[model samples]
Target: MSGSRIDFRKAKFLISAPDIAHLDEHLPGDVGVEIAFAGRSNAGKSSALNQLTEQKGLARTSKTPGRTQLINVFELDEHRRLVDLPGYGFAKVPLTLKKKWQQALGQYLQERSCLSGVVVLMDIRHPLKDLDMQMIEWAVESDIPVLALLTKADKLAQSARMKMVNEVRKHLADFGDAVKVEPFSSLKGIGKSKVLGILDEWCKPQWLMDTLEQAEEE
Candidate 1:
């Protein structure tokens, strides 16, 4: 399929509920690249994923802060898995719950060798919080590639959105090697192409790359 014609289809939920400790078990053992998404509560992580895949209600999107208590995993073409980590930095949530989710998310991020990259979502209106910075630091320390999505871009004016993206990029300059920041809007479809392009990089199965290339020349 041509890249521009890309639309989410034939996508089904493989696993709806996944706990922190059992995330590895829920994942297929065949060993392929899996991209994970992380963000603070109500950061539009789920909404963005649902929009990307064009699957409404695919991942749970909640209005209440700290609603996602577990890591949710969604399958893409049965070859790639999009992992959704629980949110953080919602001080209104209980301390015990926060710590538990944090440890689970931290373990997954730090130990998952199959994790190809992490898509960290931040609200365009309020892009970088202290907790968001910490997550970037963790990805950097682990040498994991991160793509920052300044979600809810439609909520901001066009000029303001550009300014916010630049500001966020500057803010993340210290971790340049580990992350790339871009503005995204699930509502306006802004940055959809960019998100899909980044995902394409992860979709290329290295094991099949040579074989596909040879076939293409035929």
Candidate 2:
């Protein structure tokens, strides 16, 4: 994004944490820029994450819904990271556990200063259900921008894909420019570069920007 392009292909697994405290142990004194992936349990959020990093099996795809209960982190460098949050709206989990997850997620979204933005994944066919909207709203309220990744785009015909994008955008119009929606299918590798481009901006800090520009000059 804008004269700086950090490579997503360089991303590697950082850690899998059940909560924010577990994640902070891996970071350097609780500091770093990170983008998080958030969505419903069956929204293919993990698949989209693996595709974004160009690493299969990175976030763990599953046939059973709600398999990802951990907050998985992927590291691009010492200072940049990607977070895969627990998927919501799964009935199989115990009510107590669900409440815990909801509480942790809300706290993370509100309090984590290192969090740069979030990629809200939703299946293309069932775009922006109540839970998905709630996820986006959580980020918007926290003054964080969300990139809505409409996954499984390959499941829809080309015409349907465009319609879904516009529909998602129209519903998000009230949020002004805080939210963005794009078609992405992890299986077919659709919208890979676009997601990476957004993440590149998120990953860059002032010191890193200086390094990039210095390299460009040389």
Candidate 3:
């Protein structure tokens, strides 16, 4: 898999599960690799997904925050997937609904064995809220690699954007190599290749590469 790169444009919707139980029912046993995208309600997660896959409407973008309430899965291939976890820290939602979403999110992150990595998107202007830090910390504690994507970079000048990126990197430096930070803009296509390259690397764990190789041999 050395020279191979995933064709993100090939991604298609797989399923949307409201909770881990349903996710297990549909994608039983959690047998393959899954990289998840998570963020606060207004962090531009959907825009980033659509931009990354070169699809205009892959992940639904909304003017209102907290519109994504389910766990959406998109398949890249038989053995690879991208998961859109529900947006967190939205204030307007009912308490019971919010608690339910939070519980579902917690269950998926803690129980999913095949989750390969987490892309934690944040608005460039407001990079690390308490909930955002909690997400990153949870992933790190689980030994999962994290990409702290500073989205909406187009809202800032280049120098300011890079400064924010560096600041985030500094704040998360304690996590060492487990965490990586990059500034991104879906509108400007900034950092798209870099982000894709990281995702491509994650998609090819040694076991998955071996499985792909064996499949080809068969």
Report the number of the highest-lDDT candidate.
3
Tens digit per residue, CA lDDT, model 1, 13-124: 6764435456556666736667888998878888898889888788877778677678777776545678888888766877887788788888878777778788989998
Query: Against the true structure, what is each candidate's TM-score?
Result: 0.86, 0.90, 0.97
How do all the candidates rank in terms of TM-score, highest first? 3, 2, 1
Q: Note the residue pairs that clash in candidate 3.
A: none
**Candidate 2 residues 41-68, lDDT tens each?**
8889877877777778777889997876
- Number of clashing pairs, model 2? 0
Q: What is the C-alpha lDDT of each candidate?
A: 0.78, 0.83, 0.93
What's the lDDT for candidate 3?
0.93
**Model 2 regions lying over 4 Å from their true place:** 1-4, 205-218
Candidate 3 lDDT over 27-54, as tens digits, reads 8578889999999989988999999999
Score residue 130 of candidate 3 by CA lDDT: 98
Q: Give me the runs in candidate 3 sitting further than 4 Å from their true place.
A: none
Ranking by lDDT, best first? Answer: 3, 2, 1
How far does residue 79 in candidate 2 sit from its true spot (Å)?
A: 0.8
**Which candidate's TM-score is highest?**
3
